[model samples]
Target: MTTGHPFMQAHPHQPLSIAAKILSPQMIQTIRKLPEFHLQAWKILDRWAFNSPEMLAQLEAQGEIVLMSRLLDQQAVEHQALMDSTHQLQNGMTEHEILEMCEIHTEL
Candidate 1:
C-alpha cells in the first residue's frame, strides 16, 4: 500500500485511512505525481512515524499525489478537531481499524 512518495510515514502495523484501505495501488499512483509533498511527510517518518524508506520510494515513483493529498487530508481532518479518534472503526470494518481489535471477536 505504498507509492514511494518519500513520505516514509506509514506505520507498518497500522491501518491506513479509507483512501488507502480501499485504493492502495491507486493511492501510490497519486503520490508519484507529487514529489514535494511526499518529501515533506518523509521528514516526519521514524519509529514514531512512517519510517520505511523503501515503501516511501514506491509511493513517490508511482505519482499518486491524490493518495498523498488524501493522506495529508487525513491528517488535516484530524487537526481540525484536535480530539481522540482511536476507537472508531472506518466503515464498520473491524479488521480495518488501526488499533488492534479484540481477537476473540475477530476470530469468531
Candidate 2:
C-alpha cells in the first residue's frame, strides 16, 4: 500500500478516513473535479489487512510481510495476570488448579 496516500481523519479511533465516494477514473480526472466524489477507498484495503484472518495468510504467502497482530489484546493482559498470580502462589496453588484455571480462561 502507498504510504503517501491522502487520508481523512474522520473518526478518533480509526487511523484512516472514510471516503464519501469512489469515482470512476474518467469522472475523477476531469478538469472540474468533484471533491465529494473522491474518497479514501484506501481504507477498504486497510481493513482487510487488519481484521481478516484468511486474507492475512494469503498476504503472507505472497511475501507481503506484516507484524503479527491480535484482535483481543486483553487476552494477553489476562494471561500475564494469571502467570503473576500462579507465581505468587508458588507452593500454595496446585498445578492441577492452575491447569483448570487456564482451561476455564480459554473457555470464557
lDDT of each: 0.36, 0.33
In terms of TM-score, the best-performing candidate is 1
Distance from true location, Cα of 31 in model 2, Å: 49
- Quote each prediction's TM-score: 0.28, 0.21
Model 2 stretches astray by more than 4 angstroms = 1-67, 71-75, 87-89, 92-108
TM-score of 1: 0.28
Which lDDT tens digits does candidate 1 get at residues 1-108? 423233323444433332233334554355446554443232222211334445544544566554355456544433323223333433343222322232211110
**Candidate 2's error at 100, in angstroms?**
4.7
Model 2, residue 92: distance off in Å is 7.1
- Which residue ranges in model 1 land beyond 4 Å of their true spot? 1-50, 80-108
Q: Where does the lowest 10-residue lDDT sum fall in candidate 1?
A: 99-108
